[model samples]
Target: MSAFEHSSYPEVAKLTIPDVSVAALDMGCLPPVLKRFVEDGAMRMQAPVDFIVVAALCSVGAAIGTSIRVQPKAMDTRYQIVPTLWGAIIGDPSSMKSPSISFALNPIQSLEGEMRIGHKNAELEYKANKKIFDMKLKQVEA
Candidate 1:
C-alpha cells in the first residue's frame, strides 16, 4: 500500500502526495499554518481511505474501489507546505469516489448503490462558504 492516494484531474497520472509537513506549533521556525487552518476552521485535515475533498480548491484523488489512476507530475522542490503534492499529469474522474462508479483496487471494492451530494456524481457548495471545494460524501437531492 502507498502512503498518499487521492482523486484529482488528469486521471492518467500517478502521484504520491507527501504527508510530511512541519509541526504547526514549531515556534522556533515557520509556524504550521496548515495545522492552524485545520484547527481554526480555515482549512481541513485529510480523511480516511480514498475519501474525496470536493470542498477545497484542490481535490484529492484516491485509487479505491473502481477509481482512476492519477499520474503525478515532477516536483518543483521549492515551495514548503503541509501535505505537499506532485501536481497530477491528467485529470481522471476515477479519482473521485463516485458511488455510481465502481472499481476494485484494493481490500475495499464495492459499488456505490445510491447517489448523494458528496458520493458518486455528486458535489456541494456549503451554506456558510460558497466554495466548490466544500465537497463531502453526504449529499441529499433538493
Candidate 2:
C-alpha cells in the first residue's frame, strides 16, 4: 500500500473539467459619482453592482460630452475627453436591465425637462416686454 492507495471497489468514470476563468468587477476603479449611482441602482433593483455601474457611467459620460478633458503628466499632449461610451447590459428578458438604465438617467432627464420649461417662460416674458416697449414708443411718436 503506497501513498496513492486505491479502494477495492469498482473503478468509476473520470470527469473532465473545462479550463475557464472568471473576472471580477473592481468597484474601486469607478469615480465617486458613478460608484454612488451603482450602489443606489443595486439597492433599488436587487441586482449586481457591476452592470449598474457600467450603465450609469456610460449614460453620464454621454450626457456630459466634451465638457471635461484628461491630461497626463507622462504624456506630451492633452487628450480632449469626449466621454461618450457605449455599454451592453446583457441578461435574460426577466432581468431589470432597462429599468436600471432608466433609473440612472432619470435625474438627467428631469433636469433637461425643467430647463426646457424655464427657457420657454423666459422667451414669453421677453416677447411681452418687447410688445409693451413698442406700444409706448408708437404712442410717443404720435
Best by TM-score: 2
Question: 5-108 in candidate 2: lDDT tens per residue?
Answer: 75775678898866988688888898887787788788978877766776777777777778876665457566544445888887778677877777777877
Give a tens-digit lDDT track for model 1, residues 1-142.
Answer: 3434554444676888779884333323323542333233322222212232122113222323125333344575454334423322223554434421121122123222333324633433344344433443234321
State, as a TM-score between 0 and 1, how close model 2 is to the true structure.
0.65
Q: How far is candidate 2 from the true structure (C-alpha RMSD, Å)?
A: 14.3
Of candidate 1, the 10-residue stretch with the lowest lDDT total is 99-108
In model 2, the Cα lDDT at residue 106 comes to 80
Clashing pairs in 2: none
Which number leads on lDDT? 2
Q: TM-score for all predictions?
A: 0.13, 0.65
